[model samples]
Target: MAARSKVMQLFKALHRTRKEVFKGDDDALEAARQNINAEFRNNLTESSPEKITELLKFGTDVEIILRKTVIQGVHTDHNRISIKPRKEILLDNVPFNHNPTIKDT
Candidate 1:
């Protein structure tokens, strides 16, 4: 009974995190919903207490990672957010020179 309760709690927490993290993105929210449902469904047959505990730990870790990294929100200077760009894009209206030779007199 306790194990079942724990599982339910974890499931609910995951959904909440998804809602908060994927705000303004319906496709992402739906994808997360599907993935979470599929994972829980696939693990329906899991019975061993040890295995359940391990799985729960993994789920918790995943939630923490997603909240800390994937999710973006307003942050302070002390806690800066880092977003990595896939590829460098030049700013609009910026002039680019191919060759530059410095002649010193």
Candidate 2:
């Protein structure tokens, strides 16, 4: 329960930051780009387009962003989803410990 709440909090923070950053923008491209960049820096390999498109269906349910043209079949489904950049951050906020074992030659 707490984990879900934490996730929601983080998303809310992200949305708030996004609105502030792009008040007049028609899309959330800038915010999405930043999120993706941050995710990449953290070594969170993002899923491919297949996954992104699957995600779009969910986004529609959430009413985040959608295009009427796409809905009307004027554009491809890929164009409908503006995939925001994503990063994989640990929920517990623990520092990663890398310990490699040495082998005798």
Candidate 3:
């Protein structure tokens, strides 16, 4: 019973993240929706608690990755595009491990 609740929570959270990550794009949104549904449906008969827990963790990680790493770019002009990054992405400013990072330059 507990595992079932967790599964539903993770599933819904992933969908919400998908909406924010793929906003304003019908094709991408539909694809994401289908993918999420398919993944959960694939595991609908899962009866192993350990395996379900592992899958839940993976789903949670995926949601985080989508929210933090996915950026939406909108076409504006022929040479210019606009980006609206989610706050989750901009909040983490991890620079590469180089002697001279962008901040130093």
Can you give the TM-score per candidate against the true fold? 0.67, 0.28, 0.81
lDDT score, candidate 1, position 96: 75
For 33-54, candidate 3 gives per-residue lDDT tens digits of 9999999999999898889989
lDDT digits (tens) for residues 9-75 of candidate 1:
9999999988877776688899999999899999999999999999999999988776766744433
Sort the predicted structures by lDDT, highest score first.
Answer: 3, 1, 2
Regions of model 2 farther than 4 Å from truth: 29-105
Model 2 Cα lDDT, one tens digit per residue, 1-105: 443454345445545545544445545557565763464344334345555444444434333332211121123385574433223211356767698679899
Best by lDDT: 3
- Per-candidate RMSD, Å: 12.6, 17.5, 5.3
Looking at model 1, report the run of 10 residues with the lowest lDDT sum.
Answer: 82-91
Against the unseen true structure, what C-alpha lDDT does each candidate score?
0.80, 0.44, 0.90
**For model 2, what is the alpha-carbon lDDT of residue 76?**
37
